[model samples]
Target: MKREKVKHMSVKGGASLFALRIFVTCLAAAAWWECLFSVFPGMVVSRSWLYGAGLVLAVIIGGAVSCPRRKVAVPAVILAAALLCWRFFYVIQGAAAHLVNAYLAVHQERGFEVRFWEEGSLSAGTLAVGTAVLVCVPLLTILLLVIRWGRGKLVAVLILLLPVLAAILEGAFPSAWATWMLIVTGGCYLTAAGAGGRDMAGPAGAAWAGTAIAAVTLLVLGGVSVLAGRAADVIRLEEDGFYSQTRQAIQTGVVDNLNAVRLRMEGQDEEADDRPEEEEQLPREREEDRAEVAAKEAPSASDEQSETPGDSGAGTLPWDTEADGMTDLASVARFSPDGTAAVDVRLEEAPYGTVYYPLRWGGAYTGQSWEETSGEDGRDSLFLSWPEGLDRLEELCASWPSDTVEEAEKQIDRELTQKAVYDTEPGRTPTGEDFAEYFVFESERGFCVHFATAAVLMYRMMGYPARYVEGYAVPASAFSRQADGTYLAVADGTMGHAWCETFEDGEWTVREHTPASDGSASPGSETQTASDSALRHGQAGDQEKAGPGAMRIAGRAALLLAIVGCVIGAFFLQAAVRRKRRLRVLGGRNRTKAVEAIYGTIYDRSRTMGMKESSPLREETCRRMADMWDSIKEQEMRWLYQLVLESMFNEKRPSAREYRKAMDIYRKTGAEMYSRLRGWQRWKYKYIWCL
Candidate 1:
């Protein structure tokens, strides 16, 4: 009875130790995330409360799922952590890297110029969720694993150092809280090591102890953080002494190394990315061979010089011609769609013979709107991949609109089109950055204006002189022969459309590349395939078709069943894999680790075979299993219990002879366990759960 009481107390202490570590680790991770949230505010939507909520959610998830007692597979925990914080991994790293570069660049003045401004950053809400899942969730999981079963104290210290150092490197002050968290975590871990899983009595008591520790830590650390932020200079540790000199040197070295590491991570060297912006560049530098070839083939800036209005606007694009254009590019003009023709086109064989006539030019692209900048010097094409997933489209139709015109500027082009005209699109708000950003990145369904706006922006980004032109399309088949041997196309208000024109190779070309309005591929759309068209068109027809509807339902049902069956199959498969791994250890090297399998196999086989309690480690369970056999093997049962104890409490591994004896009992115990059970229970214990 005394031995049983001792074992019970031991289990409680172990649980308490694990629970304590988990709580402290979560606190450390949340504090780190909070610091990161401050430094990189753009991680989520621009709201402190939202990021706070996200941090809370991540901490809770990390603690609950990663508790050592859960015994979750390492790979599964990693996958779950990744899935939880997938959004942050996708955007935060890149954005934060850029923001760091920008911050450093502002200080450097001439090193590592980037295009972060041109490329829009993340929405605040997305950032909040991603950082929580990516950083906090993973931090908790890693720390828990490190504290519970990791190699050494040094590993845990190194892991804890990352966030504290990152916050410091990012130049975020008031980072005392994170630093304190790290210091406290290290101290707690050391204390835990000294105690050796003893001081606390039960899991519940451990939790209360952890909460009290965390609260005291927060009170002290939170005060320090606030004080540091409010009066950093007042409490500055600077004096004319050896200590001060050494501290400054260490600080400088650390910062330089961190920067070097960051540059390497971003795939850049010290002298890299300092080239001409107009030159061709790849989105990723991992393809070093390709990037070098591009650099070699790129034309120098002096090759073709274009006239620039000294201060017309700081940007080369239409909106860049004015400060407001950078913010208000393409605010859609509002009007009720009462069949109004935005522009009429009349031409012999469609001037460019591609899409529509572009009359008005939206030049320098500022942010808010297109600022028309006057240049007319040289046609430029970067001929490169766009950074923000915008492929530089070569819509240069080999004929300049200026070259075709003789007397009038745009009036003659508008008067010379003979064909169908598309109508002005329905007025709707296109928010964020500008109409082009909304159209290109966000809008899946929008009006013709969106298509045209995005096209013009892509062309400008390609380094070609392009303009957003609202004009009527000329579908050749819609035109009829007039009495004068000429085709007469009606400029219907319903046929109004928009397109883009650009100067390439000394000629003006138009590209009326817009997605089809019907949401399926029109005959001439360059973007979609027949399969996509069939899938999209099938959406409505599946509901309408009686025969196909039944098949669709059946297919869906089958898919659901397959998914459910696969989930159940996976659970069984994982159990089998774990058991197989344990069995190998039972007979393999490292008999110490294998000893648990000796008890585990017997425990599992005896579970539902008249055993009432679930725990297999109990002495009562050992006696019950011993009772099942016809001939009592009391001596072997006592030895089996002793082996379990040695595996847990003793440092030394079980000898080969000891393990062999356990295995023999393991087999006999299983047979005796099966003989006592009813058929179904035996099958369940022997195969399903036992296996």
Candidate 2:
């Protein structure tokens, strides 16, 4: 009886430890996501909070399912960890090598630069050796470890990781391979952990208890999946995922800088109060100056003094004395769209597109309004307009001395090279030098942003209404082939290219410059098939194409589908892949510690986003809803806080319904708060939150 009691106590202790570990890891993960969401407004918009939460939950579910508590589980875990570590070592080495080589070879031609690397400073030939040793060796070692040392389902984990590693390596692209490898590794282990399995006390009771446990788990998992889907939607609705805030900050800085310069030029010393009646002040100044100069000069002195104006508004400011057409550039907008065509111009560390925020013009240029422009059918194209007054463009086009397209292209190549690339180094930073000199000095190696900005300003110098446009530059694959040789484009994620659009002839047209002139094909050039010419006309088809609004809907839908698909697919795939392998449960002196570590990690990550207690008083909720706080809404935060509190403190876990409700409110609160802040302020809030 005493022995039986001791065994019961041991089981309880193990369960308690397991629960504690899971709780701590989840808690840490929740806190991390909460801080991240609050700090990066884009993160909130992108639904990163829920995305992360879901990922952590997946890990917990995986670990719980894989509960290896027998004698052989130890070596299986160690082998898996070792294999993963070796894989990490190889991937890192490759990335580091690429970065170093790219850093060194910045000036090489695209061809000569040698994009791919195999091993340490060597060419592709050495790759085979490394691959054989690093990949094949570890894979073989893992299989051997499982077959020899592992006794149960742990053998299946090795099988799952093998094909995933192969897929990652086959990808060719370093970035793609590295990232996908990480995702695959995470998925594989989660599966081998028996993510789909149920628990039973022992072989004798396994059948009955497993059946009960399995039923409960399925219900619990299904419910979690539903709640997760809702949470993902909430996040997607809020996050912009990129530089919306940064662009706003830069634009504000530009405006403030320009305003300061204007203010300084206007000099407050010459206020209206300082000006006496012109005749009266002139005569009084003349009499006083005449008396004073009587002792020092003749008529010649008075004539000279009258010719020049002093700080008292008699003399021009140095800024005014500069040549005409030399002033700083002006802001230009879409002439057609009242304020509809604006996009965000702020700089950001992360990539955000123009859809969520509109860019604002800060300079002095103006253009034709929407009413002045006409579309193909003699109507306005949806919000499409451009800067007007293109005499400068006419002169540029006319002066090239070559009327043929080929000659024009060649001349453009030469001029742009001299104007952009000659005498420049590859990756040097730009500074406050002559604008043209700065471009050439900086070696024109910068991205489209620099090229487009410089070109726009140069156009403005020649008196043209030129504004920058930011949008997706879809690659050829986005389109479908038709009967003719032309292509029809569709919107896809790969369309994340940047280029400038100029308004001319009552339509916004693509502006071709260096890239095309240099003989590189545009994104859509090669994909055209001879019989696909009809697809070109597809551009003019009756399709009422989705605009920014439609694209947004598509993006959200894709994100949602991706979230659901990844979770479900990963779970099932993991289970199927591991079903054939025998299970190995952990034992030995250090087994408990390993389990503790793993459980601890899981708990911390899960609770990263803190839950709250009961809904709070309205007044307290109002007071707590600071703009920078991480919750969805000020008032709703009280609800979330209550839920989190209950989840942490209450002995009984809250129903899935309660969790879902809290998550929904949290997202709504964030969106509402965002709507209230200016772009700059929003960015500032994100920044502080991140910090």
Candidate 3:
């Protein structure tokens, strides 16, 4: 009668423990759902179903790995800690970079220049979340350790309440609070479920079952949320008229700019015709013969141009032409050091053509620096409307069989360099002489600017519209390959360069005439061709082209899948190995060890199958197993138990025949219990071992 009462009490306690675990798991799952929603609202868009399913799977896997019965919890805790540290370090580094940039901006006249690193700098909300994670991860680790080492309900409840309290206090911030709540509650539940005590066994199965149900429920809720969000978006777009008006305003502005450009170009042509031919043409023969001696006597044209401009604004544009303080020669004659990273460019959409870098254009040199020439004249001449001097250059370009802007640019570049020579010396040009004319006909050996200026003037003189440009240039050789096949080109102060562009097919295309002095290809030349081709082909077959945001989503999804797969694979593999080792012991020649292995397997299987209360099974092993068994199985279990006891304590070994009989009974009992379980129950039994 006493034994029966004790058994009843044990069963009741087990049921209560199971309920507690289920409650904790649910709380944890809810917290996780809330947190994810807060961090990435867009993740719950059209693909809410997928995101929901993924969330459910993540919860289940996290619960299982952290379950006290598994050995992986320690490693999982370590990994989580490492991830937190990495995030902390990343945030600190970004803040430092921002500070440096801010300081530099304050000192410089141009103010702050935005760089690529600043793009990913943490915002206020993200920083708040990161701080929370830093605090929570360590706290959770300590809680897990406490539960693993010393099990108590008070400690578990307190740990679980931390996140709950946080959630309530910051209830207005649902995502953040929910994330905290989920991480705290889930971590606490896992620690409790895995910590083996009197009622641990019964609750193990219940905890797993509750996790599955909770996952499905959350998935359904996520889908509903997605549908509602979509409906709201539709209503919002329909009600908002600002977007339509803004788009119309943009279109109107573009048309006005185009019209302005056309009127300006026409006025420039009229002005050019009115000016004398003598004023435009240089004294070519005299300049060539006197160039070398003129270098010593003439004042630097650069210095003369720099003197304050007259009211006419003949030497510079009406806009600020103050030199950015960089030497004028630096813009035309510099090269980036090999392997320096300058800029990153990505093509987020398809059907995109070659990339172009805009440099100085619609401007003429003031003998000192390049400046915009659009003053009282309505507009400067664009490439489409060339001056009469470009007739020969136009004929040369027309003779080439190029079908595209890129091909045409390439042909023009080759022809421009064929007649030019590169001069390495700085400060070699004679002052007061026409810089372009001297470089082309007299000097013939200046650097990039000289070559570029000559090319632009030559193209224009031959009736093909061209313009000189100057800015930092990144060559193909300086670019490094990225995993996505885009190239990262680095340019520094030394890479400041000058080149030209010609109008083709209604668009201005880059043309490089600078010789490869360092044996490096020009920017957008042969070196980038392979990478460009790869980008084109890579997009051809992608039916569902994604934007930058979608790509980020896809990358994160892939990472999550990888992590989940590894955890699941590890769990199953560990279980399989342990089972195989037990089987090997059962089939061994050592009769004593074999009998012990068989009895232990049977005992664990009984607890796992929930046939006996987990707590009592530890102390009253024989009695608990006997009461849970039927007549035949109970008798068999008692005999095996006694034989295992004799082998362990009395130094009396079981014979080979006895070991075989014990193995047969253990296998038979497990099979019978497994066959009676429902499909989901069987799955739970196979994956999670409470003992």
Best-matching candidate per TM-score: 1
What's the true lDDT of residue 249 in model 3? 48
lDDT of 2 by residue, 1-691 (tens): 5336434644553454344334322332333233322222221122343334334443434343335653455455456656855766764465345433432343232213445445444334333233233333334334323322323344445353333343333221123233333333333223222322222111112122223333344444444455454334233322243333343344356644564576568885354335343211111112232221221121112223221111121121111111221122121210110111111111111111111111122232232111211122212223222244444444564565654433543454455543442111233333333333344333444333334444444443333344443233322122222223222222211122223333344443333343421111122211111111111111111112443345455556656665665665555444434332212221112333322222222222222223232233233433334333443335454444454444445644545455445433432333334444575654432222210
lDDT of 2: 0.33
> Per-residue alpha-carbon lDDT of model 1 for 1-691, expressed as tens digits?
5346434644565555555665566556555555554444433334464446554654454455445544455556566656744644556574455445544533222223455443246666655554455444555555655554423557667776665565456433324444665566555553333222211121333234434543554455445444343222211211233433454455357644675587789888754456554221111111233222222333333423211112222112211122433223344532122222222222332111122322234555444455543344324332211224233122322222434322122322232111111223323445444455544433322455555555565545444555654433434333322233333333233344455555655644454455443321111221111111101111122323434335434444554555555565465456445544554555567777666776776665555544565567777777887775543376778787888887888776788788777765664454445445575664354336643
The local distance difference test score of model 3 is 0.45
Poorest lDDT segment (10 consecutive residues) of candidate 2:
333-342
Task: Give model 3's TM-score versus the native structure.
Answer: 0.26
lDDT by candidate, in order shown:
0.44, 0.33, 0.45
Question: Model 3 over residues 1-691: C-alpha lDDT tens digits?
Answer: 5346435544564455444544554455445445534432322222243234333433433444446555675576567657756767775454445434433432221222445335245765444344334433444344433333334546555655553453344321334345545645555465444434321133344335544543443444344444443233222222123432453344356643564477587886575457454222211112222221122122223322211111121122111224542125323332222222122223333211223333235445443455543222212364434334434445655677655555555565665554444544423456555555555545455566667666665555445566665444433223322334343332332344556666544444456677655422233332111121212112211212554345444444554555565565466556545544654566566889888766676677667656645553244777677665442356677788778777888989787578667765664555445545787667655555512
Instruction: Report the number of the highest-lDDT candidate.
Output: 3
- RMSD after Cα superposition, model 1: 28.1
Per-residue lDDT for 380 in model 2?
26
